[model samples]
Target: MAVQWVLVCHGLVTLLVVVSFLCGQWPIFQGTFIERIHFFLTSGAYDYFLRFVGAVFGSKCSNAVLSVEYYCCDRPNPILQIFYLGILSMTYYFIVKSSFAYIPGYYLSGIHRYTSLLAVAVGILLFLLTSFSDPGTINSANVSQYLSAYPYDNIIYAEKECSTCKIQKPARSKHCSICDRCVARFDHHCGWMNNCIGERNTRYFMAFLLWHFLLCLYGTVAIGLVLAGRLKELRVVYILTVYYGIENSFLGLAPHVAQWLLGSYNTLILIAVFLAIVGMLLAGFFGYHAKLCLTNTTTNETFKWQEYMSWQRKLNEAKASAAALRASISGMSSDRKPLLSKWRAFFQRSPLQDGQIVQNNVYDKGFVHNVVEVIYPLSSRPSFTRPKLKPT
Candidate 1:
């Protein structure tokens, strides 16, 4: 019973940490403990650690830690890439060590041993493709091509030059300070891949996300089948029903079966739980990126649009306030009239109600076109080099 409780608690904590880390900043989670946990996991914990180091050691040691952090986070370093590989290898190693002997058991086929390796290899290939591929870097020679491909919308994107690169910046291109280069159709830089996700390699990055999700799902289901096989081979369920006199019905037998599995295969349960949580997270992340691709938007564009909408809303409110004041003054200066009834005043619409702001995304060329654009970036097409001809 104690062991079962411990496993339950461990699963709950893992789920909570994963959820908080991934979604603490979301509007739905705002002002919740999940948000606080997210803050601690992402930044607060590191801050406290740094303070502890500074207090315990000297300033020189603290400076070294800060320098390591700067290189790992603010600059283009392979720390996360190496970390990702390490985790992947270690997880596979554990799975093989704990579960491989039962691979050809009753519920699972022998072929899974090879298939699992292939799946992981494919996932790593996708990762390498995303990590090493050019993310549509805009350089001096091809700047004209990029400019022709993406015209300035004059709203979020305006006709401007990149001060750092000294080149005309195309629409949707952003200068990545970490990479120290301008990327066309820029998405956020992924620390895991240690590369910017941009026009050229967005497809690869998306594939990496989707494939890894499937891989985790595969592991979870495979491990579950292995555990189920163990139960069958050991006759644990039948023995419980026969010798222990437990009821055969699911509700009656569930607790006993659970306790048996918890006692016998706790490691497998942990691995399955971990994989399930990670799979769900990857699925959600992939869904979000898929939505962005369908809508012809980037993570950076989302922030830009939010800022634009906020500014527009504030401007509209200011104008409404001025209009209301002017109307009040004009009414006061005019010949006196009967004041409106309280009921009439109560039902009257406020001028500020007109302050609703809508986002206008010119680059969203419709669903199919948007998806195609991501799959085959405009700059990759030959027609991208051709500038629009002026009217005769």
Candidate 2:
């Protein structure tokens, strides 16, 4: 029972880690002790722990240890790749080694084997493409060119230079501290890919997400079927009779059910559960990216725009209050203004209502064009004269 409890706790912790990493934001724990704990887990505590170990082990040994730690945490590394491949390999190993081969033999007619192989192949291909592809890096040669492509909106983005890169910051571009370079139309730096998901490689990143989700889904369904076949062979009537008999005698059936599940299809069931959880998480991630593509915005821009709009609202409120005060001082009666004029005045004075303070999405060239831009980036487009800037 203690061992079972430990296994359950381990599984829950693993799920929590995976979900927290995938979600990217955790508003529920904001300003809480859990948030601090999460921060320490991700950053401070790990560094401190490594330093402590280094101090104990002597400077020379510490250097080697810290270098390995930095390689895993501070930059893109093969840890995620190894973990992903290891999980897949184990799942396949269990599938082949298990006595329940009905899924591969009768149900799928050996097609499942080929499909699984293809899924893994395609997933790896897309992963490599996303990891290695240039995510529209803004260098000295093309910095000016990329700058010309999107004019300053003057709301969220203004004419500025990256202090790190020593180059002009193009509209929607941000310097990634980890990558140590300015990324054009920068989204967020993805640690999984160990690359920035920006203007150039976002399409490949999206494709990777799609393919990975499919692979997980495939594994889940295949394993689920195999488990079901094993259970069917045990006979549902006997299982149900035992379940009800225990209930009538006031004994819990949970232990019985768990024992049967673990004993009959332990490895396959574990893999299926993990794949289901991962698939669901990947689905959410894919949906988020799809929304970003549709809205013609990056993850960085989305957060920035939200903050900018909040600031704009406060500014507009102050202006409106001052205007009202001046109008009252001038003895302008509110009743004297026509209803339409009053309404117009109210709306025009409120930046939020008028939408005047909202940042112009200069890159949004309609839905179809925006998606095409992601797939075939601006860096690859033929050189042409800079077009006139569109109005907000």
TM per prediction: 0.95, 0.75
Name the lDDT value of residue 200 in candidate 2.
Answer: 86
lDDT of 1 at 267: 90
Task: Give the top-scoring candidate (lDDT).
Answer: 1
Regions of candidate 2 where Cα sits further than 4 Å from its true position: 1-9, 21-24, 28-37, 47-79, 236-258, 314-359, 382-392
Task: Give the per-residue lDDT digits (tens) of candidate 1, residues 1-392.
Answer: 89889999999998999999989999999999999999999999999999999999978889999999889889999989999999899999989988999989999999999999999999999999999999999999899888877888888999998999999999999999999999999999999999999999999999999999999999999999999899899998899989989889999988988898898889989999999999999999999999999999999999999999888888888899889889889998999889899999999987777556778888899999999998888877878776667899
Candidate 2 per-residue lDDT over residues 359-391, each given as its tens digit: 677767798988888887878777623554679
Q: List the global CA lDDT of all models.
A: 0.93, 0.76
Give residue 52's error in model 2 in angstroms.
5.5
Clashes of each: 0, 0
Judged by whole-model lDDT over C-alpha atoms, candidate 1 comes out at 0.93
